[model samples]
Target: MSAQDSVPTPAATAPIDPIPTTSTPDINAAPHDPEDPETGEIEDPDNESSRFYGPEPDSNPSDGDSALGDYRSTRSTSVSSYVYDYQYENGRRYHARRYSTEYDLPNDEKESDRLDLQHHLFLLTLSGALHRAPISKNVQEVLDVGTGTGIWAIDFADQYESSKVTGTDLSPIQPAFVPPNCQFYVDNMEEDWTFDHKFDYIHGRMIVVGMRNWERFFQQCYDNLHPGGWVEIQDLNFPLRCDDGTAGPESPPMTWSSLMIEGAAKLGVDLSASNRFRDIMSNVGFEEVTVEHHAWPINSWPKDQNEKEKGMWVLQNVLEGLQGFSMGYYTRGLRWRAEEVDVFLASVRERMKDKRSHVYLPIGVFYARKPMGI
Candidate 1:
């Protein structure tokens, strides 16, 4: 059966199910009032002093690195004010100004640095390819959604000098210096798009957490693309897998994944939403849809040389950001205390380091073309 025939079309006005609520604080709840002055209790959601932990210190604070040392470091620049101003909650910082609280990731400098590392890791995974989509090099216009730090868009612009690239994100955390053909916009994509021109190519990477309605988001991509234009989505499916059964349900990584998935579900965020991208794109009037699956090992367990190298990068990527990734979701969605979340993650980190566990995540890449007649 064709992809289009396999999926049912969703009602446009259908009400999305709310994420299951827990005793913990509502993910969308407004910030609490300022701390109690006399009691010295931290009540304000924006109070940085009340953070459960201090910011993770950078091991190599300098931008440069030894040739043989860790991954290649990109020339880092200061965050720009063009992005949304930052706000803090439970000591973790987030985009202060946005259309909604759809995004759960941090928007601070540390997060940006991690995102840069993630970009390089992705490049390594794809063997330096920016995307798996069979897009034409002559394509004139491109739109990069959730273009954190604008690294991908900048690279795209640099590669396709003739093409104009526009990167948009909720936080104005991207660098000020960029290619001449590239520009950054601080905009929420979930809202009605008012771009003056349709794009020849649209790209979104690791934006699963930022979208509430996958069907609607795909429709928007369809509507915004020019005839025969292409859209590519790269995302990771959650709940790390164990092929060897060593890392079972009782394992720390597995346990952490379950809790994180639960937290995301309660917030109406579908971490595994990428699994349906092929069907959704086909149903949304797209054509020639294709899906490519890649496995990202949680540790260096693969015997093959290339897979082992990729595994190492993936391991480092996760280990470095594990705490930041867990803080918001656990504290807000699961309603766990900050210290409790930290302790749980410490155990999870140890589990991730175990080669016997053989845990890995599935990375999904979906690409489709807008029908020429549409």
Candidate 2:
């Protein structure tokens, strides 16, 4: 195996291109009422303009607002129990550490549901494609790192029936009933990899917080792949972006995100690693590296139909994930009390529900390939 010291420095990659956030649709805009001259069918009203009905008169502003339309802003245990035992903090469950304490996310039923919901959001963004990599149909030997819930691996295995899929994670939370060709292993990628075979495609998604040494992780992916193989990573950039000056550095979303980044850094985890995956892959000797960016609005602030729909789902995912995402970082890393963490998160949640904030998360999808002559 190559040493981490040998990894070369890579040139900087392109900056994240900002997409224009659609302005708030005017509710008083004239509604469409004209009928089609040819078919005499009534034209449907503009969905974007009609999506936000605004807050009700009787609703309390402090009660919070929903991203959809209505207003409302709403781990533990043992070593041998690593399989059966779990740890609980602030009423949330986290997977017991088997080898490392690098991971900070929970693995219980709530997080599992959020993970699946995130997968659905990815599919919606990708137009139902499993991957953006252009691998051959005859390709086999696929591996999914940090495969929480084994949903992505299961779906990939089902799509590419001819290929074998292996998913590895610290928790044995994946379902036992899976595709015949798909298998799950309770292992940590930070440790020495013991795979007996090379793969044609390697994938990792939403794994930025789980890794302590991304250079080593990418080097392992490069080493464990065939000479001409592919690798892909999907994750969100940190410290939320806002175009309208609504969510500045002092805003709730930015404040909490920055705190989390600081906390994760104290634990040797990079919450903003997605911003540098391209450079890391290049430095690790991967060729033809490329990255694509997507917009994840914090609420239903976007005027475009597609982005608004995406925003609605993203809102729910973020709201559900706020507690789990903060518990580990705030309590263990930042040395904050559980109650303090909860109080801070409540303010962040309320801020997230406000469309006027115009906060959004930048999503990055990175892909690369091993040189054929390597």
Model 1: residues >4 Å from true position, as ranges? 1-68, 80-85
lDDT on C-alpha atoms for all candidate structures: 0.69, 0.70
Clashing pairs for predicted structure model 1, backbone only: 19-266, 83-172, 84-172
For model 2, the superposed segments whose C-alpha errors exceed 4 Å read 1-82
Error at 216, model 1, angstroms: 0.8
Per-residue CA lDDT of model 1 for 259-315, tens digit only, reads: 888888888888878767777888999998876556677665655444555566778
Give candidate 2's whole-model lDDT: 0.70
Clashes of each: 3, 14
Question: Considering summed lDDT, which 10 consecutive residues are worst modelled in model 1?
Answer: 1-10
Query: 266-373 in candidate 2: lDDT tens per residue?
Result: 888888886667778999999988776666777666655455566777898899899998889888899999999989999999999887777777666778999998
Q: Judging by lDDT against the true structure, name the best candidate.
A: 2
